[model samples]
Target: MNIELVPERQYQVFNSVAGRHHHHQPIWQNIKNLLKSCFGTQSDSRLLNRDGSLIDINRLRQNINDKQQSYKKRHITWPYLLNIYSPSMTNSDKKIYQNRARIRYNRLKRTWQERVSQGDSFYVTLADTILKDVRRTDRHIKFFKKKKQILFNIMMTYSVYHPNPGYSQGMTDMLTPIVYVFIDESMSYFAFCSLMNRYMSSLFDQDQIEINRRIRLFNLILHSIDNELWNKINVNEENYLYVYRWLLLDCKREFYRFNHVLRVLELVWINSISPFVISQSITNYRSLFTIFICISILQEDRQIIFSYSNDEDLHKYFFSSSSSSRSHRSTKRILQQAQINYSNYILSQK
Candidate 1:
């Protein structure tokens, strides 16, 4: 019957044990207080009676276990609505679903065919370009041809799905690297769709509002970043045409490696952490990243660029569709430098 009270300082020991055992502090504190009140003194054993006798520790443990089990059982079942509403469709429902699915399938097929029929010349050009890249002795020649068809199908499907910005010229170039990376037709299609929806949709706008907005933004960003180079280019509505294609196709035609082109596109898409507080509206235009990237690319050739005496030279140098093989820096190097330069510029703005 020798019962001792838990000292005030000994609460730390109880807390430490509770922490290690993951026991709730309130429960453990309540148990301690009850023992103290009942016994009128501290006890070496946590479970005890008022008469200084040991209580059934097993019963207390069982009570807590039962409460937890009951709580979990009540709260962790399938959602009420799901339980009430069976997902299993009736025969009639299944028939209706199949009919709707069939209708959608027919519509999509019809739309895809219509797009293909309209863009026959573009498809032919695409096929020729695809075949030109594939060497006859290459192991994946058949796969390459298959991929070309998949790419064309993806473009047509995208055109059908998105009629507002229905298929544009550079779309095939944009989708080329996407199809190469995501080999599965459906995966490639969706990825291409996502790219278009998120970034390149503006380029295909019928009214050219998005296109003009982007061009203006690009000029704004370039001017802000480098007024000297911006002035040298002296870009106008007519002269910025090459840049339109570059931005629209994500510089796919410029870069050598398809993977490198895709890497740059994704980097632009991610819009990584920047030092400056960009406005919400400004951030909405994902193409700003490419604009900054263009600035970076231009900065690499700043010496040669500044030396250009006229707009035509500046245009040919910076915005030309020609291969960038002559460019000294690698795509990765240019991208890294772009990020660094952007971060520094933002920091300066702050």
Candidate 2:
């Protein structure tokens, strides 16, 4: 019943039943087609998402007119996951909207920037801890060379609002691709809040029980796939921490820039909206899908990963700069593979 390792092949569409398609298709197209049903077969044409919101067809289209009108818009591209939930706005309205958002962005930016000087114990404490993590996390937010302050401000603002598990170490890793995709602090912050509130909050819990449980599930599923590979890579139980890092950070630093990570995230969010998961009331689907993604990536580097007998070598092979650039696999293909992996895991259980 074990899922066998897959060799490289042409990209396939994600499917739980067939696991492959006869012809190749753009990943976005499949996701777009599923908009109406991802939430489930509602009697109304109104497609619902995680929060009972309607999906906007026009925004999903990224229509030619909208693109033409907003050539000079702040975000040149809108990620599908973010756009699906965003309100439709004309160019003029978007300009006004962004201007207002810019005002708020600046206000928060300065408010947190003052934390170092204000000497307020609370803000100062957050400021000191935030700055340390920001410095390290900023190292390879490749698209964020000059905008580290924006990253800092977003985290600071989030900390102020959420307070629980505010500004954890790996949060910056999750936020970088979001900010890059939205290219606007306000949109990024809002989207980040949504993700934290629903799908990914478990990763941020201060206590370790939920985190450990999920990692245990990851190890359990991985062992089910192949006990030998699991035992090899998971020596000393270190791969649990590695998987935790991947899950918590969205594996953000593992690629050339944020593009791969964003695509990976796009797939993750797509799963969050999946009818099978949502209709079945699978509250932990996001964490579940993300674990499959971790496995997909691990399986890709299997040959090289297997060569490394020790955790340290595997660690470098995973996170080292040279290793980062080593992935030639399409993000879409990896995601499709995850679909197969998840399906096979489910079948094996039965």
Candidate 3:
């Protein structure tokens, strides 16, 4: 193998598997967040404008708004997980799929094949939604590939609807799973765009104010938990660059390990709509506290982290540890303990 040559086939194989697995957590979390945000007392109390006007957070949740609910139920069944996979499941399955990309690609190919065979013209609307590269830029062309045309179209529609945001690099990653699930490309685009409008304010911002706000929130959490760690990292000075992308994109780039990524995503999704319990004191904070809870979970593994300085070692530990019974149990326990103390300290002042 040429050392410098791009492993296009291997890349696609890994991405397909990773994408499919990653898809589940976000969908489940989004649904849970939608429901909890609507029904949960904590979140309902917090969703108000600066003027104290109520925000209809529930409007963002999923429901049987139309015929789509029935359709959603059909595709989201459990058995479909096994049914979707190729027959030749093996240890080297990813390699086989490199020769022929499995699952999602097969699904996409099948859908495309059916549309072509039926002579369906439904794809035209989807094509129109794709934004023209008016500048005809090479970067745009490279970023938006043929495989991602549908994703691009949907994101383009999202951009138009949220004219302030227009388009951004991270938007495609957020929307891809939505496009894959809806099957009816056009409807999927609209739904995903709508869903995004609720939570994606930072990416489309002129000043990236929301990103800054979240970073502040994280800093507050770090101060509350481990003042020493906070000072050591010097977040204001940009020492913890690793977490910058994670917080900004909400962990999309860092979470190649499917299960752990899904776990974190699910936690956020469930918490999203619930009103953030702001601290009553000047010391109070928001979502970043939970991020500290996550970091504390990793604290137990800090020795292992230090032991293996390479990226692969860290990846292996994060992935392997997430699936281990003891580690998962420990993470849950730490989260519960931290939340109780943090909540008491915050709520007592009010």
Q: For model 3, give the RMSD to the true fold.
A: 20.4
Tens-digit lDDT track for model 2 on 97-214? 6677668767776775677577889888887788787787747546687768778888888888787867677887778767766867777877788778766676788896667776
Q: Using Cα atoms with residue i matched to residue i, what is each candidate's TM-score against the true structure?
A: 0.56, 0.67, 0.46
Error of 3 at 62 (Å): 15
Which prediction has the highest lDDT against the true structure?
A: 2
Alpha-carbon lDDT, every model: 0.57, 0.64, 0.46
Error of 3 at 331 (Å): 8.4
* Poorest 10 consecutive residues by lDDT, candidate 1: 76-85
Candidate 1 per-residue C-alpha lDDT over 20-133 given as tens digits, one digit per residue, 9 for 90 to 100: 886577786897988765555432233334332335534333332222222222111111111211234433553564466446545665654765468777645644444443
Kindly indicate the candidate among 1 and 2 with the higher lDDT: 2
Order the numbered candidates by TM-score, best leading: 2, 1, 3
- For model 3, how does the per-residue alpha-carbon lDDT over 124-143 read when each residue is reduced to its tens digit? 33334343431221232343
Lowest lDDT 10-mer window, candidate 2?
A: 64-73
